[model samples]
Structure formats: C-alpha cells, structure tokens
Target: MVKVLQQATEVDYGFRPSYRKVWMAKQKAIAQIYGDWEESYAELPRWMLRVQLTMAGTVTVLKTSPIKLGDQVDESTMYFHRLFWTFSPSIEAFRHCKPLVSIDGTHSYGKYGGTLLLAIAQDGNSNILPIAFALVEGENAESWSFFLSNLQSHVTPQVGILVISDRHNGIKAAHEAPENGWLPPRAFRAFCIRHVAANFSLSFKGKDARRMLVNAAYAKTEAEFYYWFDIMRTENPAMCDLANRMEYDKWTQHQNSGRQFGHMTTNISECVNSVLKGTRNLLVTSLVKSTYERLAELFVVRRQMAEAQMGIGAGSLRSTRQTGTEHPASVAYNGSHRRP
Candidate 1:
C-alpha cells in the first residue's frame, strides 16, 4: 500500500484517484505479477494518519468530541465528531486574494457520514481559491459557527470582509448571532441569487416570473431593478412580497452596499464542491488529503499559466479582445479626418 501511494504521488503530487480506481489498479497489479492480496476500506483512516504525520507541519488538523472527561480518556466513549484542515500554502495564498468569500456545505458519503463545509475565495483572475475545509457532524447552527470562527481565525482577519451563502437558516443565524463574531463591523453576509430564484419558483409558477425575478436581482441600477421588479409585481404580487421580505441589500446587485464585488451567488463554492465529487465516498482522512493535494496541484498549474501570460506583454492585442467594435489600429482617417 505504501509503495502504491508513493508511486501515485510521484506521478502527480495531487494523486487524487477514486477509491474504486485504486481498488481496480491494485486488483490488476496483483493478477499480473504479485500474489493475491486483500485490502479493505476500513484501513484507509490509518493510512491517512500516516500520510498526515509524514507531512506534519504542512497539514493542520483539529479534532473535537463531546465526550471529553478531562484526563479520564475513555477510548470507547470518545469518537471522531468534527475535523477541520487547512494546508500551509493555501492559508498563505489566501492573504493575496480578494476579501470576498463564499461558503457552502455538502454531504460526505464516507464510512463516517458527515457534512463537508468549505470556505472559498476568488482570485483576481476569477479562479476558485480554497481557504479552509471542515467535516462536521451535521449542518446546524453550532457546526457553522465553529467552522466560520475557525476560518476567520486561521485564514481571514480583515475587517469589512464579505461572505456569500444560500438562505440556510443555520448560516443566517450564525452570521447574525453576536457571539459568532461574524456580524457587521467585521464581516458581512450576502444571499445567493440562485436560492432566491428557487424560492421564487416555489411561490410563483411560470417561467416569466423566474426571468423577471432574476432580472431584478441582476440589475445594476435602482431604476433597472424597479423596472424588472414592477413587472414581477404585476405578474405575481406574492412573489414580489416574498422578495421584499428578504433584505434587498443582501440579494440585489444594486443594493449590495459595495461588498459583493459583482458576485450575487455562491456558485464558486458550489463549483469546488462539484470538483471534489469523486472523493465524497472515501474515508475521512483520505478525503482531507485529497483536497489538500488537489488544491496544491491547482495552485501550481494556475501560477504557471499566469507566468506564461505575463511573458506576452500586457499591452499586446491578446488583452484587447474585449475592447468591442472599434479597434484604434483599424480606424483609418481620411484627409478630412473622416472615414469614407
């Protein structure tokens, strides 16, 4: 197992293969050359600990349980309840990215079923920058508060930071609670437009209503917002009422109070969740290791791409594709300073 892991890591430092892929590779190698060998998924936690210990300083782990009896240390009574990890480099890189972060949670299908919560940021080039990850017992107020408190302490401590998420009650409560320290004066919260649209669809049935609601949320000016919102009001007053009940400053682009940075949704965090879909069924430790390795590989690849782009002068034509319609070099002036 150690040899295979080492070989995999050598091939790609990220080395994130699904458990099924690993199992198949092992089966094939055994049939081809080595004698019969047996392995079970139960051993993955031990192997993951070994890897974490090997890379001790690079990986940070925090574990907690409800059965803390103060030095009594009952082995059977104590079990893994929550785990949070962040790689050294990821934490450092987050300092350079935007203060805007989107957080979300997804369920993990590993042997110990739990919820995986992630806090992700966006780089200047619009790439997903992972900040921290946590595996909690459930998606409740306590879990979210714990995750966000740790994230703030470890990754971001700047004031006026913006956080985006869906309308989950737990998230809402955590950010609003004074003790959580996520309220304004330090951090602000924004709602995802997608979740708003989903709620609108539930209350109002037609496609046009959905379109109108989206238009209002995406409007860049107050006049444009009213124009779209009035249409929705006329079509279905109840939908408008539901929307008005929500703090317009949180979901509407025009009323975001300059915190959202033009982002109206939590799609960035959702995209990261989708990228790790394959690792959902792995053991807890393997899941954490895979996330670290994958993020490291992404950082390396993106940095190389940025360097290659930098080699081409910034003032070159490659950067002017979005200038639209009139190219300064293409306009030819006649003797009268006018085009024929």
Candidate 2:
C-alpha cells in the first residue's frame, strides 16, 4: 500500500506520504468502497440470497445470534456467528471427481478476524475443485463440526468417501464423532502426510527421518511400506512407536485401497486457500463476493476447455472413420482387435 501510494502521489506531487497516513487513507478508501465491517455482516444475507436466487441449487447456511431485550427477543437484532455455502456447479462437479475430500482452514486477515474452512476435491485430470467453504470464529471442535457436518449433509453425502486433513484435535474430534458421519462405514478420515511428517520431525528430527515417513506413506504395497517402516525403526525406535500410535492405515497409501486417489496431503485445499489470499483482508461480504466471482470465472474457463476437448475428440473420430480400413466402432463391437 505504501509503495502504491508512493507511485501515485510522489510521482505527481514530488512528495512521499508517511506509513500512518497511507494506512489511514487505505482504511478510509476501503470503508468508502466496501462499507464498514458491521455493514458487511448485514449485507451477507442479501448477497447470499441473491446467489441462491440466481444460481439454483446453491446451498447457504447462516448461523447468527439473536439479540434479546429483557425477556423478549429483538426481531431486528442479530449477530453473524458462522456461514457455510457451496455453489451448485461445485456440488455437481464433485460427483464426477475422485471420491476424496481434503479439508483445511486458513486465518482470515479481515478487520473482523475469522477462519476460512475449505473442502476440495480432485478431478480425473488431477485438477483441483473446491467444493465447499465456510467462515467460522476459529478452528475448533465446534467450528469443524459445523463445517464438516454441513459439508457431508449437503455437499458430499456419498458414503465411504475418504477425507484427508491434518491431525488437528479439532478435526479429529469432529471427524471421529459418531453423529458427524465421518467415522468408518460412512466416511474414512486420513491424516495429511505432510502434517504427519512435520510432527514426526519435531520428535525425531533430521530430513532422513521425514523422508522415510513420506516414503512409507506413498508406498503402493504393504511390503514396500514395511521396508520404509523398518528403516525408520532402525533410525529411531521412537519413530515407529509414534507411527503406530497415529495408526498406519490413516497415513499409508497401501492401507486405503486406492480410496485416497494418490493424494497424501492437504496441498490441494491449501492451494485454493492461497488463491483466495488476496481477498483475505477484505470486508466479509467483499471476501465472499470475491470467492464467488473468482470461482465463476474458473468454471467458465474450465467449461470452454472441456468443450474444446470434446471438439478435438469428435474431429479425431471423424478423421479415423474417413481414413481407416475398419471403423473404430466395429473393432469395439466385434472385440477382434481390442485388447483386454
């Protein structure tokens, strides 16, 4: 901000403003443009209503605390507590993507501090698709329960889905709770390998120990996983004990039966978090607006790419029909030249 002010003001007036002045001016400009923080909270309902009205199937859940006067509730008074929203396209897109969800939270830098929780999925082409978002007071058991419960109830209701996240107690508490639908036979929970390795490093130390943990996590076979496991045991017996306590099935690829879709970390969710980094400091409504606009633009671009791919596929099929001795359809129907 100071640099921008220097470029805009100093170049014209040959004078540089102090940091305080620039900051105050920026705050005033933000207020003038996006309104104050309290007003942004007031606008959340209207903005969310417009989103749902225009985009059918969009889900929004807003939790607010009602203000009370003596024994009666003031109908006009309410304070924003939490919000969970997901777009229709994102919800539909998850159906075709891998049956895995990675969730993570990042701190919001707005004047009214909060945390943004994200749930992301990976498409067949390995593209990251953000499926749901929630703004909460912080990353706690209650907040995680609020986000994950809504995510499962509305966004990812498919049973036996794999959920990957860090080893936060809040996430564990929420995921392990029987009513949250994140336990076994409903949805499986896995720890992010990166976070697991980081915690291991804190105890074991050294890059070699971390590398061994990562190798074990990425092993495609039980034998290969044990090979790395033995190496960690040889390096430090304590490492094996820690791994055992954390449960090998949650972090090891071999135990998940490919349900993890080769994802070992919450990097996809963190990538989406970084994508929204610029809007973190904006007013609440503006931050939500930015996510909506950015995701809409992303959907438009991906749609164009998909259409282009379809066009290319059709062109190749027509060309093959014109130049080939036997039709591709006959090869598939007759199963003569098709390889099993």
Candidate 3:
C-alpha cells in the first residue's frame, strides 16, 4: 500500500508521499471503506444475524468474551473471540460427497491479524466442496478444539468419516481427545501427505529421497509401500526410523482402509484459501461476506451442472426407447453425454 501510494502520488502530483503520510492515508481509506478494526469486530454479530435471516438454514456460532469491571461482567462490552459458520446448501450437499474432510488454517492479513480455518470435503467427481469455516485468534489447542467440536456437531456428524490434516500438535490434541468424536470408530484422522513429505525433507535432503518418501506414502498395497520403504531404508536407515515414528495409518495409503477417498492432501482447503487470499486483507465483516458470496456462487454453478446432466440422461433414455435400439444409454461424467 505504501509503495502504491508513493507511485500514484509521484505520477499525479509529481511529489512522492512520505511513508508515514501514505500509511495514515491508507488507514483513513480503510476506515471509510470498511470501517475501523474495532467497529468491524462490533459489526460481526449483526452481520452473522443478517446472514442467518437472509439465508435459511445457515448455521452460525459466534463466541464472545464479556468485559469485566472489577467484579461484574458488562453485557454491553462483549469482545468477539471465535466464529464458525456453514451454509444450508453446503450442509445438504455434503451427504452426497465423499466421506472425507480436509482441514487447514491460513494466516489472515486483515486489520487485526488472526487465522482462518477451513474444513472442505470432496465430491465423487473430485470437485472441492467447502463445508465449514472459522475465524480464530490462532492455531492452538483451545481454538482447534472449539473449531473441531463445532464442526463435528454441526457440519460433519456422520460416523466413520475421514479427516486429513497436518500433524500439528494442536490438531492432534483436539482430535485425539475422546469428547471431540474424531477418534477411532467415529472418525479417522490422517496426515496430509504433502506436509508429511515436507517434514521428511527436513530430516533428509534431496529430491530423490523426498520422492521415495512420497511414493511410500501413496502406495496402495503393502508390497508397494515396502518397495519404496526399503529403498529409502537402503539409502538412509534413519529415514525408515523417522517414518516409522510418524505412524503408518496416518500417512500411508495401504493402512488407511480406503477412507481417504484418494485425497492424500489438504489441497481442497488450500484451494479455498487461495480463492479467499485477496479478501484476507479486508475487514472481518467484509471477508466473511466475500466468502458467503463465493460459496453461494459455487453452489449455484454446481446445481446447474447437475440439472443439465439429468436432462441429458433423460433425453438419451427417451431416444433409445424411441429407436428400439439394443445399445444402452450411457452417461459419462465428462460434462457432456452422447446420444444412444
């Protein structure tokens, strides 16, 4: 912003603005456009309430801390702490998607710095379906617990679901805790293969070793996994020990019971983060509104595609019956179908 202001002024008035002057102007502009940081925080409850009212079945959970004056808590002076929200269509759509969820957190570059945590699911056709979102202070045990607990209760309550994420201690703590329902028999936890391979690179350098580790993680059978595992062990015996320490089912495909649905990474969440990257610099209210709009757009497009496919299938079947053709009506998911 400072550089942009400097260059703009230099071109318009032939005078480069001072860094401090540009910074002050930027703050004023933000205040005028999106309101100040504190005011944005105050607008959160009203914004969420409006969202719920405007969008039926939209779920929003906002956590606030009450300000205390010596001994009494002031009801009028509550501070925003955390928020979790999911749209009605997203909730309904997930039942038809693959039974897997990938979660990840991206740093917010807004007026008040924080973290944006996301939980996204994948459809049968390998499309990313964002399910839940949260704004928290940072990634910690308490924040993760709050996010996961709400996610499990509101968004993904189905049993035997798979969750893929990085092996952050906070996430581990939250999922492994019995009350969160993310433990065994309810939901299985797996590590993101990309993150696991990145960690492996920290211990062993070179692309060859990293590729070998990834091959092991992606192997779908015991024999294939050991084939790459033995190669890594031969190259560096300590690498085998390090990989063993991280556990097998958490990273390896062979041990995951096919629950991963071929999604070995948190790429869905990463994709969502990239889509919202520009909004990260906006005020909290603005950021949330942008996400709602984007997700609504996604849902509308997907719905139209599905409706078109159904129409194509119905037409194909009708044509086959009219012609009395022995050839069956085939429907391929390549966004278009052929006549029988």
TM-score of each: 0.74, 0.88, 0.89
**How far out, in Å, is residue 318 in model 3?**
3.4
Best candidate (score: TM-score): 3
Q: Measured by TM-score, how close is model 3 to the native structure?
A: 0.89
Ranking by lDDT: 2, 3, 1
TM-score of 1: 0.74
Model 2 weakest lDDT span, ten residues long: 331-340
Better of 1 and 2 by TM-score: 2
Backbone clashes counted, model 3: 0
lDDT of 1: 0.76
Candidate 1: minimum summed lDDT over ten consecutive residues — where? 331-340
In the range 1-340, model 3's lDDT, one tens digit per residue, is 5688799999999999798788777767777888787888878889889888988888999998999899999988788889999988889989998889999999986666899999999888888988999999999998999999999998899999999999999999999888888998999999998999898899899998889999999999999999999999899999999998987988999999999977899988988898888788788888898989999899889989989888877777677679876254454555244554
| lDDT values for all models | 0.76, 0.88, 0.88
The alpha-carbon deviation from the true structure for residue 240 of candidate 2, after best TM-score superposition, in angstroms, is: 1.0
